[model samples]
Target: MRLLLASLILLVFIPLNAQTTRKYSNEFMNIGVDAAALGQSNAVVARSNDVNAGYWNPAGLINLEDNQLALMHSSYFANIANYDYAGFAMPLDDNSAFGVSLIRFAVDDILDTTQLIDEQGNVNYDRISLFSTADYGLTVSYSRNLPIQGLSYGVNAKIIRRIIGDFASSWGVGLDAAIQFETDNNWKFGVMARDITTTYNSWSINEEEFAKVQNAVEGQNQELPETTEITIPKLQIGVAKLYRFHYDYTLEAEIDLNVRFEQNNDVISTSFASINPAFGFEFGYIDMIYLRGGMGNFQNELQIDNSEQLTFQPTFGVGFKYNGIQVDYAFTDIGDQSVALYSNVFSLKLDFSIFR
Candidate 1:
């Protein structure tokens, strides 16, 4: 455990200059997965205990005494995009566990007008084509319970791939480390380092595929170029406490703070501002039914001008469990960044004890 902690510190603080111009490569990996976590505004780093913990805080896997499988689907931007996730976890020994998960995000049937040209001067609709863009990730995780009664540590290795209509593609890999602690009084704390080794995506472009577009436009001399982008490391901290009440009811409240390290290109700002905070609450009855709500993406008033406004994305969800099976549904307001649309996520999970 001591060696693991030392390694995590070194991985996070290693000196690597980040690219200033290229930002957010393979961003699909940042999108939160699973209805249960998204419903809590992604504030479950401290409370995650299901198979989805492989994506949230891998250290939470130590809390799982049973083998579990989880599957989720979410529609974004009013059905324009689809995001899916699947994960499985199993206890490897009395004090250690392993998990694997896959994520896919895709946008299909986009009209490709780059080749819309004909011998005649008139535009030809028949020349138009349709294409799709997709991103995929695979994560392998392992967790071990420390000698301390309530402390656990975990690590994840992830591979990412992206494809754009058969014209371009990219591949990358990264690492994540996490630690969690729970007290006998029902208080939990967690810390996670995302992209601890820094993620790098090397893009390969096929310039020949865009010859038609270059020919159709006058004075167009641009060509696709191979490039690489780096994703800076991010740190997340969370704390939660659970309250038990009469009638077999329990309530949990949590808050998370996320800090991202990257360049601030705004000429007006003197330094980088990369802090984001979120809050979530959940209520459960008989440990079978749950209600959840949360909010995230908050910025200080000083960060915005008169022309710009801050928007808070709110989320709500519900869950049901019966006979070792669980189903969850979540609704989120995606705001107007792209399209004014709401997102709905649904997930199913099954659990069975390995020892039994």
Candidate 2:
């Protein structure tokens, strides 16, 4: 009971110190994968138990009893962008495990208008071209059970790459660590430190092309500059509980709170107004079929006058498992009024130990 009380206190107190800011970089890394987790509004820090744990909370990988592989694909942001993830986990022993995952988010075939005009100020249709923008990350993760019962820890080392067609590219490396505790009475707590190394992306531009472009518009007051970006650290805390009923039915509820520390106007500080919280619920029958719903991005709107804030978004998902294989689907609202606001995600997971 004391643990429950502590969890409640944390949920309420953490966001009070959150302040809003917009100086952080690498926003694409914040896009979550896994249909099941997304369906639950990404409140999986304490509830992740499958291969997807490598991306959500690596410590959760300790709960897996078998080797597993999972893949996910989604049509994001007005259905014009593609986001995909793949993860695999292998248990080394009863107390340790290793995992790896890859993520790619891309927008393809975007029209390049920079070179569409000729020197005579006439539009050259033949000069029009297409290019792509992509972000990729490869993560290697490890997890192990601690000497203390019900406690576990994990870490993920990641290599990140971003490309703007062939014009510019950047590379970065980062680390993430997580710890989780599950009590005997079905309560779970999790904390994760993301980008512990303050991932830095050093960009390199094509100099010859860049100079020509600079000379092309020398008097027009337009210029492109190469710069480095740093991804600030984000901390996440989560709590969850599960209940089981007769006939193999189970229900679960989870909540996650996030805080980001970054340089706001050249001074490093925590943005108290940027505190985001997510909530999720799941129902399952005999571990075969599952239903989930959640809400996310609640920016501490506790007052009545601020009831119409746009921070909250609804998410839903469903899953089916049979013969060691699971397929899941999720739908998310991207916070827009148009039909494009809705995005669809699909995922498949395979457990290989079941066959062996």
Candidate 3:
């Protein structure tokens, strides 16, 4: 465990050549996957004990009790954008696990108006066309025991793909490392390092499409766009605990500190890094029916007088489990940004042991 921790630290802090950190580059992946997580403002790092762990905290995958499959779908901005996810995970043995996850977010049916004014400047509605832009993430993860009871480590290999109809596309790769530890008292702690090695995306633009758009307007498309994008490393630290009101009633609460290496709108602002804290809890009756809620994304908004006032996003959700199948729902904000649109998210999980 000591060696593993040391290596992860080294990788996270190591300097890279030509580092190009940008705000919200490949940001779609951060929108989150499962609805249970979205409800808690993505604070499930410490207790994600199922297939969904592949994205939250891979180390938690070690806690899975059976082979599992998961699926989710969500829409944002009045259904203009759609997000989808799918994952599969299974325990390889008593001390190890493996999982794979795929996520996609897209905006479709966008009108292309470049050719609207044909050669003679005639108003031709028939020239209008449609296109779509999408972003995708694929992650393969592995978790293993750390030779210490209740302690485990995990790693993820990721592939990122972005597309804009036939005009442009990009491909990138990155890595993540995480750890989770549980105590006998039902206290769980976890840390996840996202894009720990710095992710890079190289884009290819279609000159044919560029020419059409450039000629559409005299003053536009004057220069070639930057084809490279970079995503800096981020960290999430979480702690959670479970309490029982009785033999059949229970509650679990979790708190997470999400950190980004660059300053942003987080309430805890700093030039080096900013921190956002999220709190969430779940109440369960026999672990079959559940209710969840949370609040997060605190920000200091500048008012008319330049004075800052605090604001936060609130979320709610409900879940049900029966016969090895579980369904969850959440009404929450899209990403950590204080977007007013609260999207509805749904996810399904199935345990393969039911077949036995």
Best by lDDT: 3
lDDT of 3 by residue, 22-80 (tens): 33478888888888888888889999889999999999999988999999999987787
Provide the lowest-lDDT 10-residue window in model 3. 6-15
* Candidate 2 backbone collisions, by pair: 17-272, 18-271, 18-272, 18-273, 19-271, 19-272, 19-273, 19-274, 20-273
What does the lDDT come to for candidate 3? 0.86
RMSD of each: 9.0, 10.2, 8.7
What TM-score does prediction 3 earn? 0.92
Best model per TM-score: 3
Compose the digit string of candidate 1's lDDT tens values, residues 1-356.
32233233223312244332355565678888778788889898998877888999999998887899999999876677789999999889889999999999987777666556677766888987777777899999999999999999999999999877656778899999999999999999999899998888887766666455456445745444436767778888999999999969999999998777753422122345477788888999998999999988664333335454455668899999888888999988765223467888899999985225
The TM-scores of all predictions, comma-separated, are: 0.87, 0.85, 0.92
Name the candidate, 1 or 3, with the larger TM-score value.
Answer: 3
Better of 1 and 2 by TM-score: 1
Runs of candidate 2 with Cα error greater than 4 angstroms are 1-23, 211-219, 262-273, 300-310, 336-340
Model 3 C-alpha RMSD vs. true structure (Å) is 8.7
For model 3 the local lDDT of residue 288 reads: 98
Q: State the weakest 10-residue window (summed lDDT) of model 1.
A: 6-15
| Candidate 3 residue spans exceeding 4 A from truth | 1-24, 335-339
Local distance difference test scores for all models: 0.79, 0.80, 0.86
lDDT of 2 at 2: 28
Say which prediction, candidate 2 or candidate 3, comes out ahead on lDDT.
Answer: 3
**Clash pairs of candidate 3?**
none
